[model samples]
Target: MEWNAPGEWTPAAAAEPGQPRKGILLIHGLGDSPWTFVDIAAELSKRGYLVRTILLPGHGTRPEDVMYVTADDWRQVVRQQADAMRRDVDTLYLGGFSTGANLALEYAYDHADVAGLVLFSPGFKSLSLDWLAPALAVT
Candidate 1:
């Protein structure tokens, strides 16, 4: 659906006369689109937050588009979006799901000004060796 495309919501300044403006940039998972955060963004806006969701490189189009997409590409987009979001609000935060969660964590790690992170099932740790954990532990 067209509504699934990237989205941004900025609450009216009148919503909180003297409250500090807060913003959050959300990222979608490897095979997901900005749609993932649509509902969440709306809810955050109702609470006076400036919310944004962006399509990672190679996303919001054909699946094959991601075939050659690199982690660097994703990092670049997240960095840009976060930077822009920072400019729009007084406090900045990041959030994501799955692969997106990993990217958010990476960016926040180096950007201390980021207020916090809202991660959903971050995919950073490798589970490939988990299946062998039992056997190795027994040794």
Candidate 2:
């Protein structure tokens, strides 16, 4: 029922019950699922982190789901989960790949409570259609 599912955010197994919680929320890119971070989450878990990944709405499902999805959909998911995690963990981090990184960046900007951010292949520049390029372009 946990991570064996394609898109579930399974907590790391090594975390203790009462320690100062350090949690990481991992997000996958377009057309991908939480499964993308399985190995990384497991490794982080082994290192004593509470690792959770989320299935952005319209993801881990049929391709048609993406066609109807919007930026608000992605933002809403990250916002809600990050907000919830902040209450549950002493330290909360957001890590993502590609478009997921874009969502994480925006969420981190708006939510300063986040402890740190881990991004891979962040794609906001290309996906933003040059709108965010002037200010956010990594290059």
Candidate 3:
């Protein structure tokens, strides 16, 4: 999948004029990029929805960058995208996977105007990195 660099943002595929939008903002998991949601976005677009995926801070370019970013950085990016979408569409939806889901939840909390949320493998709290030390060491 093609990846977007940090600080780079892309607009959602446009819908036909007068077509009511099902606006969706898709967030990628840790170490992943907006490209992760290409399939999902395509499917949503086919279903008459305007789907946009965002690359969170320090993601999509290098894994090392992700290690340097704080959770708040991620939250800010999601919030900015959500706010932009809210201004353009009639109904808004947020969705993501893993840590991305957490960011989505945080966005929803701040933006209660969203119509709905769709989470995949949502995380209520952080996962224990210590538990995966063995696997991480090998990688």
Candidate 4:
């Protein structure tokens, strides 16, 4: 529950570092942290990709942090992480789950140079917009 605990959101590297050919920016779902993407980031790292599951503004910390965060704050975090990763690799890819997927989509849409995307369980119309409106507004 504490920030940066074991298996928590902190950038990691492969056992044997390799040339950074591809980069993957992993994002977790709403109310979730980067722990979920650890394994995937490792696998991608081993495959010669620079992978990092960043700590979004409201994530990797106490849940209450989310209330003071906004969509723009989250987007800025992704942009900063993505920019750093992109500088070290050839191709950049965005991968995310749920709201993270929405962030990825928005980033990809704005940056046509993004190599590709890998979304997991992206939120669509099935998600309750009415219920989410209040949550989003507080941020």
Q: For each candidate in the order shown, give its overall lDDT on alpha carbons.
A: 0.87, 0.78, 0.76, 0.77
Candidate 4, residues 1-139, lDDT tens digits: the string is: 5333223222344233663367788888898878778778767766666677766777666778888878999999889988987786678899999999999999999999899999999975664558777667643
Clashing pairs in model 2, backbone N/Cα/C closer than 3 A:
none
TM-score of every candidate: 0.85, 0.79, 0.78, 0.78
Off by over 4 Å in 2: 1-18, 127-139
lDDT of 2 at 132: 67
TM-score of 1: 0.85
Model 2 RMSD in angstroms = 6.3
Q: Check candidate 3 and list the clashing pairs.
A: none
Off by over 4 Å in 1: 1-4, 13-18, 129-139
Prediction 3 TM-score vs. true: 0.78
Error of 4 at 41 (Å): 1.3
Question: Which prediction has more favorable lDDT, 1 or 4?
Answer: 1
Off by over 4 Å in 4: 1-20, 126-139
